[model samples]
Target chain A: MIQWAADVSMLVIGVSLLLSLWRVLIGPSVPDRMAALDAATANVIAGIVVFAIRDDTLDYIDSALVIALLSFVGTVAVAKFLAKGVIIERDSD
Target chain B: MSEILTSLLILTGAFFLLVGTLGLLRFPDVYNRLHSVGKASTLGVVSTLLASVVYFWAQQSTLSVKQLAIVVFLYMSSPVGTHMMARAAHLIGIPLAKETQRDDLKKRRGSVPANE
Candidate 1:
């Protein structure tokens, strides 16, 4: 049952990743691309988790956590740059 | 029994993840897309992680702390990231969909200079 579920979920997640890729390819605006990318990141993490289930190992969870942290930072940095044109602004106060 | 529950959770999570991506593909604007991605994907990922926790606990007779940590971290971070991206998009004047009824931020911020 776990094997079957993992297979199905991995397939579903792969399709999702493809869909998000399509959105990224033709997204009309910057945030549209960013949103797609964010969704893709989530999909990737889901894939990794499902992989862990399939392999019956705890190894992938750490990598998923790392991906999550890195993607969050990247999203924030890009969003800040898009909004204010700088990731780390000099004192604005 | 535990396998049944884990499988159910995995299917549920996958369904949600697919829905979130479909929304991202079909939504007419950035804000709408962000709305879809933020809520649905987070739920999807968390559900999948929970499934892992269940599977490990049932199989190994030990809790999966890392999976639980990921779940908690996701809950905290997904929204903040989404909000930051939405605010950035708005500030930079990513145009709203034609069907948008109102923009309260515009009223409050008093005419952001269009940068996009």
Candidate 2:
């Protein structure tokens, strides 16, 4: 039963990843692409979780944690750059 | 019993993830896409992570701290990332959808200069 569930969930995650990839490709603006990329990152994490459960191993959980951290950092950096035109602003104060 | 619960949670998470990606693809504006992906994907991922915790605990009788840490980290970061993206888009003067009736931020801030 768990195996079947993992397979089905993997299929769903695959479809969602493709959809997110489509958005990333054709997004009209920077934020659109960023949002799609962010969603895709989350989908990847979900996939990793399902894989871990299916294999009955705790090894992949570390990778999931790392990916989540990196994606968040990437998103924030890109957003900051988009808004301010620079990642690190000089303190005027 | 635990297998049944795990399967149900995984299916539920997958459903939400599909819905979120669908919204990301179809939404007309960046803000709309952010709104959809931000909330839906976070919930979806969280649910799946919870399922992993449940699975590990049921099968091995050992609690998984990594999954719980991921859940906490995601809950904290997803919203912040979404907010930053939306603000950045706004600051760069990305136009809204035709259906958007009001932008209180624009009204109050009175025109954020496009930085780029």
Candidate 3:
């Protein structure tokens, strides 16, 4: 039963990933792409967690944590760049 | 019994993830996409993480702090990231869909132009 659930969930995640990929590829604008990327990152984390459960191993959880932090930072930086046109700000304006 | 619960949670999470990505693909505007991805995907990921935490606790007889930490971090950050992205899209003057009826932000902020 556990294996059946995992297999089905994996298929669903795969479909989700593909849909996000399509959005990333056919972006009409930059922010759209960024949003898609953010969604993709979240999906990947979900995938990792599911894989960890299926494998019955706790090690992949660490990778999931790291990816979560990195993706948040990446999203914030990209949003900042989009808003201000520069990720790095200077004191002398 | 616990195994069944874990599987149910994971399957539900996967469903939400699929719904989120579907919204991302079909939404007509960036803001709408943000709304979809932000809410659905966050819930999806959180549910799945909770499942893993439960799974490890039940099967291995030990709690997984890392999975719990990931869930906490994601819940805290995902909404903030979505808000920032929405603000950025607005600052850059991304237009709303034709079906949009009201411009609440413009009404609230008046004629002040975006920071270009």
Task: Give DockQ per model, in order.
Answer: 0.78, 0.88, 0.90
Query: lDDT ranking from best to worst?
Result: 2, 1, 3
| Candidate 1 per-residue lDDT over residues B12-99, each given as its tens digit | 9999999999999888889999999999998999999999999999988889899998988999999999999999998988899999
Q: After superposition, how far is residue B112 of candidate 2 from its true place, in Å?
A: 7.3
Q: What docking tier does model 2 reach?
A: high
Kindly provide the TM-score obtained by chain B of candidate 1 when compared with the true chain B. Answer: 0.94
Tens-digit per-residue lDDT, A6-69, candidate 1: 9999999999999999999999988999999999999999999999989998999999999999
lDDT of 1 at A1: 85
Q: TM-scores of all models?
A: 0.96, 0.96, 0.95
Error of 1 at B103 (Å): 0.7
Q: What is each predicted model's overall lDDT from 0 to 1?
A: 0.93, 0.94, 0.90
Which digits, one per residue and each the tens of the lDDT, describe model 3 over residues B27-93? Answer: 9999999999999999999999989988888998898888888887888999899999998998778
Winning model by TM-score:
2
List runs of model 2 lying over 4 Å from the truth. Answer: B111-116
- Residue B37 lDDT in model 2? 89
| Model 2, residue A67: C-alpha shift (Å) | 0.5
Give the runs in model 1 whose Cα sits over 4 Å from its true position: B111-116
